[model samples]
Target chain A: MEAILKVEDINVYYGSIHAIKGVSFEVNEGEIVTLIGANGAGKSTTLNTISGLLHSKTGSVTFMGENLGKIPCHKIVSKGLALVPEGRRVFLQMTVQENLEMGAFTQGGKTLDDDLERVYEQFPRLKERMKQVAGTLSGGEQQMLAMGRALMSHPKLLMLDEPSMGLAPILVEQIFDIIQELHKAGTTILLVEQNAQAALSVADRGYVLETGKVVTTGTGHELLESPAIKKAYLGG
Target chain B: MEFLSYLISGVSLGSVYAIIALGYTMVYGIAKMLNFAHGDIIMVGGYISFCAMSYLGLPGWLATLLAMAVCTVLGIVIEGLAYKPLRSAPSLAVLITAIGVSYFLQNSALLIWKAAPKVYQPVVSGSLTLFGGQLSVPYASVLTMAACLVIMAALTLFISKSKMGKAMRACSEDKGAAQLMGINVNATISTTFAIGSALAAVAGVLLCTSYPTLQPTTGSMPGIKAFTAAVFGGIGSIPGAFLGGLLLGVIEAMAKAYISTNLANSIVFAVLIVVLLVKPAGLLGKYVPEKV
Candidate 1:
């Protein structure tokens, strides 16, 4: 499989504290790669660094054969990399449709309209609540909206951070099912999750990160059966 | 008839305050800081147009356009020089810099244009009597009110419909998320300041024409009053600024006519204190819930 996105030996610091230290990872063109870690393990930080919200001090992020060094966040988005941020940070003041429209901000009118239709088709709940303010939506709905908004940009790579962070178990299952559906429909994903059990189930490749360093790398099935991972993460 | 005239004057004054308040609300919305220099920009704009009209003998509308152009460029330069570098600094620091810039502007104008008042040509002159010749409204007042409405309506539509408007809204909501959505947050903020300053230029020109005098401190009282209107209406909300300005104008005018003229300022301020005590978020402001 061809690597679509690559992060090699990247280090990120927030003030004096090192957040992501010498981390390296890659996502193949048609794969769901999950990054599993404990609390304060820098899972979200890694995603943020990739999306250009936070700059990395060292190393390179080559996306689709282009080096994304020192590029501003907006310019990075224009290159077809989208991050569905942690906590589902939808524009609370805007309507669901407006939030989706903003996803297509860099695109032309014709592309934007087409992408809006595509987003509505995938998340019909968003369609029903199109005119409703996003902040008023439930947590699960906002997460869907976040994903739908990112999809509006037609990203070649979608990175999701803690998509199931605050939700009922049933909602978590539904979200994972959507992830599976998207993966089957040929979208590359980089998922960061504290929910190890569900994340491993859908991911093709998995990396266990501890304290900002990649500790183990394997196929999803191998990581799921590993005793150490099972004990620390799955509570088996 | 006497009461009707006061109301007419109030509406006209309110319109000026409303346009000025829009600048304050918008700058606060995107930049998250008070552009204290904003009010002074109005004075500078007024002076610029006055010069163009008096010395160069430019037409009325052309002078207004030139003022707007100068103010827009000046706003960009001010933001780039004074505000941009200190963006991540403490809010108090940025605020003090703004005050410093405000004083710098006033002093510069005093030095250059002198403290003496200059006669201003009314953009629209003459008065028309109404309601059996008891109530009369000046054409300048009518023009001021019409310009204010047109601008307010156009801005509201721009924000609600335009892509850049959505980008501005997004930046105000979450800077990081906005950037992640392919929005140049800094650019959005700069555009917000430019628009706000452009409106200030319009407000300045119309305000001077209404009063028919240009002084170094012409914008001081009206600027402060407009700021009060922004706070009264809910600082970041667009319609709040409009409503607050109009209401403040009416309230101030009514107080002057009905109550003691010396006590009008006191009465207007007292109303603000009462409103703030009851609703700390202002009339239309959203109550920001603490996330943590």
Candidate 2:
């Protein structure tokens, strides 16, 4: 598989505190890669760094073959990288349809109508409540809108942070199912989650990040059986 | 008949206020900064119009257009020089810088244009009585109302239907998410400021036609009044600001005629306070619950 995104020995700092320290990872085309970690493991920080929300102090973030180190967040997105940020940051003031339309803000060359249709097809509930304000949507609905919105950008690499963070167990199952559908539909994914067990279940490959460092990388099944993973994350 | 005339005057003046309020609301919406220099930009417009009409001896109509163009460019420059650099600064820092810019522009105008109020002599010196009552509607009033309505309509269409408008709305709603979607946040914000300031210039020109006297501090009353309109209509809602301005104008005018002119300002504020207490989000604003 060809690597779509490569983060090589990148370090990110928030003032004096080192948020992501010397982290390295790669996501191949058409693969779902999960980053699993406990709270404050710098999983989100790494994702943010990749999405250009935070600049790296050292090393490089190469998308395809081009260096994305100096690119602004909007330009990074135009290069086909989309981040569905944590806590479902939908435009609360806008309607569901408007939120989806905004997703195609970077579609400089493509027609948005096709993308809008695709998003509607993927999330029928959003289509039903297209005129309703995003903030009024339920938690699960908002998560779906967030994913649909990212999909509207036609991203080569889709990064999600804590998609199931505040979801009910049933909604979590549904969200994971949607993730599986998205993966099957040929969208490359980089997922960060605190739900290690569930994340490891669907991920083709997994990275265990502890305090901003990648501690382990393996096939999902392989990581699920590891004793360190079981004792700490998968409830023994 | 007397009350009707006040209503007419208020509507005309209110429309101008609404246009000016747009600049404030748009900048606040996208950048979350007040752009306190907004008022000074209006003052600059008045001065520019004064130059074109008085200095260059152009007609009022042509002078107003030129002033609008100048003020628009001024607004874009202010964004580039003052607001853009401080995009990531604390709100307090940005606000102080805005005030500083406003004061600087006003005082600079005093030095350049002189502190004395310029009497903007209108080309049309006569007023027509309409509706069988002694009503004074200057040709300038018609021009102002028409221009305000056109701009308002155009802006509404742009925001609701245009691609850049969608980007602007997105940026205002969620800057991070909008950026992630490839919206150039800076460009959208700058465009917002430009459009807003241009509208303010138009208001300033028309306002000067009605009053014909503009000083360094001419923007203060309208500035504060438009701010109240922005809040009254819902700060971020484009149409809401227009309605709020009209509401305020009518309220103040009616209060002055029925009650006392001295109490008009207080009455408007009292109404605003009541409206806010009843609906914290302003008349047209919706309450968006934050996720803790």
Candidate 3:
């Protein structure tokens, strides 16, 4: 009952293939929940369904106790859910500032600039390159820009899909630090990652996805300590 | 003095083509479809204004506005009915659909108005003398050029400064990413169609004013020319369309004056082929490598 987002027994299909089967999870308010999985384990698919980019074949996605069925992808964002997609699909031709402005497209008035300022403060690197075109930025900078752009919408529930997919080790640490800062600032997050180590380090709870199903779930620490997770994901 | 007159008329003609090309480029930008029917919308606009002023006795300003309104609705309707359903279809199918719509509009206009050329008086009749009559440019030519500039200026500001404009740009960059930001991709696309169609109407009305004749087939040649301009400038680029239109116009005028009128279109197409061979991305278009 206390969960801000509840995914109950959802099944998603891509064409004739079953992409996700009977998957369920809960994200409570003010908690960072991570979904750690190997490639082709349907990690991105699960997040895409929740973000309304992909439709579920069965079951329900309830956000704040409201069913998010048949809602268009854009409407889902206006409902205070933002997805920082994989590959950091920022508008490459636009300047950093313009990309941020697009995040607040649903808003009617003055708050857009204010929201942009808030985002800039959170990601100062974004502030420095506000006028730089997004494509010209490095891979890590583009990832930060993607996260910052999503934050500009003042989303109640933020979803990050593989935020550290291609960053250097140092940059990955910086990215995780920013994520921890966001969590501390009370932003509820649903994180999807193949980098189980960094994801579990900051996550309050974790779910292990394999073959399109949740095989195990626990506190971040418990998953880190588990022998199976250590052998498979943590490279122990 | 004679050279200045030719330059003025060429510019005036080029402005009309630019307006039409703007429609093609804009539709292609947001929807990624060629919108071949766009040129025909200009024909409809010309006929609408012709009917309103000639048949209904409305004033020219009111008639032109009516034409604009009708064309805007028609554009939206075509997008909603014809293009929206095929959003996910392959590019070839959509292209064929656009060509079909173009033919349908042309034939329907023929059935309603016949093929007879209707004489259209320039909105502001007669030529205006400039530089002590050393260059006598028609008022219609001056008006057409001014209108083109105003529209271009307004469009530039809108794309750069407005929220919806920003959304359109975002969609052009990546539709899925734009949707993640809460932009309704379908709605943005519809708005783009509306704007493009309105510009088509402007071009149609102005073209008729300069030439003072309207027929069901009037838009065909100009439509092809404008499309060539779009390709010449770079299909998805705004400034590219403008530059392409102006250059094509000047080239056409030069070919007619110095060479033969029969060779004008050939020269224009030859320039397109040469430019494309030299720079396939168009003059102002950036080479965007597809992200793997």
Interface RMSD values for all candidates: 0.6, 1.0, 0.6
Q: What is the interface RMSD of candidate 3, in Å?
A: 0.6
Global lDDT of model 2: 0.88
Highest DockQ against the true fold, candidate: 3
**Candidate 3's error at A175, in angstroms?**
0.8
lDDT head-to-head 2 vs 3, winner: 3
**For model 1 chain A, the run of ten residues with the poorest summed lDDT:** A107-116
lDDT of 2 by residue, A1-236 (tens): 89999999999889999988899999999999999999999999998889888899999999999999989998887788889999989988789988988887777636778888888898899999999989789999999999999988788888999999989999999999999998998889999999988899999999999998999999989999999999988889
Ranking under TM-score, best-scoring first? 1, 3, 2
Ranking by lDDT: 1, 3, 2
Model 2 Cα lDDT, one tens digit per residue, B1-292? 6776788778878887888888888888899998888887888888888889898999977987898899888988999998899989999999999999989998999899888888876644566678765666767767766877898899999998798988888888788888888888888887998898888888888788888898999987888888899899999888888898888888988888899999999999999999999999898876767557
lDDT of 3 by residue, A1-236 (tens): 27999998888888888989999999999999999999988999998999898999889999998899778888998888899999999999999999988887777757977888898898888899999989899999999999998988888899999999988999999999999999888889999999999999899999999989999999999999999999999999
Tell me candidate 3's fraction of native contacts, as a decimal between 0 and 1.
0.94
TM-score (C-alpha, index-matched) for candidate 3 = 0.98
List of clashing residue pairs for candidate 2:
none
Q: Model 3 over residues B83-153: C-alpha lDDT tens digits?
A: 99999999999999999999999999999999888988567777888787777878899899999999888
**TM accuracy, model 2:** 0.95
Chain B only, TM-score of each candidate: 0.98, 0.95, 0.98
> Which of the predicted structures, 1 or 3, would earn the higher lDDT when compared with the native?
1
